[model samples]
Target: MKIAYTVAPGRGDTDLLLFGLSRCLLEKDVRATGVVQINAARDDAGPCDMDVKVLPDGPVIRISQSLGREARGCRLDPTALERAVGLVETRLAASVDCLIVNKFGKHEAEGRGFRTAIAEALSADIPVLVGLNRLNAEAFHKFSGGLATELPPNIEDLACWMTSVTAAKSSTA
Candidate 1:
């Protein structure tokens, strides 16, 4: 079954939560793959853009670039995002226990972004954990056909869900 966690809109901690949860799972030896967004460091005191880093210290790809001195107008690189999705697909084919996608945002809602990758993982019967917000909750519901579970931004809750799902999968195996 597919599962997702929804963070409230404007709550800027989704990325951090994903990263932390992935780290926790890694410590327990769960095989997972996906990209997580990290804040870019500025040298000359300018606006910082976001970078997508493959989990567990893989390559970092710049997904957004600062449009101007203001940090408000960052532009997402479509090519970079596509490349990231491709990488995730490759990982999914390698038989991971779970997939941790960064978010099911605008592109996913419109059948873009990592939508195909998400579907591929589900088809492989791999549990997926993705970030979602109120804005895209309806779209996600429609896309997931009500099979997705909305999880709060709590590590314990996420861990518990993961444990249950993985346990069930193992039993069936």
Candidate 2:
């Protein structure tokens, strides 16, 4: 099971990193599946709107809600996020070289989000990569049974890891 995760210091840095990494993998003709978040800034200067695009090709779905400007809690739209997860699950059922989840976030930590899909990919021997943070680190570690490789949070490192894993898969097959 080739499972790896990374954490970026800046907000949205990991999201952008995965997005670029997926695109690069596609350019190299790898079948990278799953979702990467794209954040759009709000005109009102409130929190950015979050959308997840199903990888390879996409049906972008908004996973963030517009809570009142004064509100200060999570703006995640659970239904929308589940919708994105459904889309990713469909893609995962097909042959994929890798699965790139934007984050192993609150939902996943609670065993609700892409947790199942991630496990399924590993079971099928497809490489899995995800963005994770300190908040969810312990939960994710437990979920992975301490097998998840921690990659440095940078494009070069990520790309190299992907290349190595994909090449390893290729040779094994």
Candidate 3:
């Protein structure tokens, strides 16, 4: 089953949650792959964006940068984003136990970002865990056909779900 951690904006430590969960699952010998956002330091200059890192200790690649302009927004590098997604796709092709994507944000709501990678994982019958906020919850539901479970942003809950799904898969195997 596809699962998503429903986190409120700025309320939950999503990066830490994803990192910890990935580490826990890896310790269990489950082959998992995905991307997580790592925040870089911000100074008086402005807000530094985030780096997209592959799960299970892959290289960290900067994908967004604050573009100081009339309309201030982070400039996302499509090439870098695609490369990160490609890494996930490569891992999925090798048949992993689970896939954990960072978030279903603007790009995803617009049918971009890791949308394709998520679909590929689901099509491979791999359980997916993603971070989603209220703004995009509806879109996520519509995209997943209600197959995604909204999980609390807690390690215990996530670990439990992972155990259950992996166990079920193991039994069937």
**Candidate 3, residue 82: how far the Cα is off, in Å:** 1.2
What does candidate 2's lDDT look like per residue over 43-135, in tens digits?
999889999989989989999999889999999999998988888888888878899999999999999989998998998889999999899
Write the residue-wise lDDT of candidate 1 on 1-173 in tens digits. Answer: 66676584554588877878888888887777887777766786775567877765568888886676655643887788888888888877785778787888888898998898888878877788888877788898898989898887877788677767766776787
Estimate, for each residue in 1-173, the C-alpha lDDT of model 3 and write its tens digit: 55555573474478778878888888888787898888776675466567978976798889875666443654787788888988888878885788888888778878988898888877766788888877888888888888777787888888888778867776787
**Per-model TM-score on C-alpha atoms:** 0.89, 0.97, 0.89
Model 1, which residues run further than 4 Å from truth?
A: 8-10, 41-47, 70-74
By lDDT, the better pick of 1 and 2 is: 2
Model 1 pairs whose backbones collide: none
Backbone clash count, each prediction separately: 0, 0, 0
Candidate 2: misplaced stretches above 4 Å? none
Better candidate number, 1 or 3, judged by lDDT:
3
Per-model CA lDDT versus the true structure: 0.78, 0.92, 0.79
lDDT score of model 2? 0.92
